[model samples]
Target: MQEINSIYPTDKKECYKLILAQLKSLLEDEPYVIPNLSNTSALLNGALTDINWVGFYLLHNNELLLGPFQGKTACVHIPIGKGVCGTAVQKDAIQLVKDVHEFPGHIACDSASRSEIVIPIHYNGQIVGVLDIDSPFIARFDSVDQEGLSELVNILEIACDWANVR
Candidate 1:
């Protein structure tokens, strides 16, 4: 059985370091897609603080379909260029919004989400999915969070097989 050392350092950077190490252990030699995403979301949900939602939105056709997640029920589909998650894919960049209410076309899958960060996930030279995290407090995410989560997503990008994702 895999056991996560959930007790993380208060220092954000150190916390992420430990989180990444744990993720590597969990994903070692596992190339399957959905299970990896599911475990990743669960791991982040446990490691992160003050975040109410953490999940993935996979690219399908021209839209994003919700995949594995650890939170309340979410919007099943989001079009590219529409919400924060979609905007990340459309721009092919990270969307770190201090206040979701301030975003022009923010999609409120959870009304309580005040801040959000979306990172586009790439695989085999193409965008495959996204990592979407939400917090109830404004400005909950910052550059540190972005950098750390981005690294975590990078690990996901290489660890899972995307060709068979469905």
Candidate 2:
């Protein structure tokens, strides 16, 4: 296989670049739903750099259930307003935690995840799921990531335009 060049010379910027590109490809002609979840999880886990957890928690019936994922075993479910991913959906905003330990009501899905960025997936004016990424280093995420991932969600939102994200 051919090795790919880093989108950014530094690790952080490359992470966003790879994620954005792969998501664009994955959702290209692909509708957002159960069929795409598996590939999305794999693409997230494999394409991104330095991530300990790359997966999704789908919003269904007012609760979050563990969807396709790549990492250690994670929480099976989270209430709409609970934990990092859940709260993101509940609040309909992105949560970029510099340090999960310092954040109030943060759930330690994996002790190794010191930092996290969770973006709410919106559909038809409602939150339906979250794109959650985790890293083992504190302050691994920043505002740039928040903005980049938010754009990612928009792209995905359009791809899955017919599905109910919530």
Show the colliding residue pairs in model 2.
128-165, 128-166
Whole-model lDDT values for every prediction: 0.93, 0.78
- Largest lDDT belongs to which candidate? 1
- Candidate 2: minimum summed lDDT over ten consecutive residues — where? 2-11
- The local lDDT score (0 to 100) that residue 134 gets in candidate 1 is 99
**How many clashes would you count in candidate 2?**
2
Backbone clashes, each candidate: 0, 2
* TM-scores, one per candidate: 0.95, 0.84
Write one digit per residue (lDDT tens) for candidate 2, span 1-166: 6433343445656677777887788788877576576777676566656679988788777789888788999998898778888789877878988889988888888999999999887777877788899999988778777877777768777877545444
Model 1: runs farther than 4 Å from truth? 1-6
| Residue 129, candidate 1: C-alpha displacement in angstroms | 0.5
Residue-wise C-alpha lDDT for candidate 1, range 81-122, written one tens digit per residue: 999999999999999999999999999989999999999999
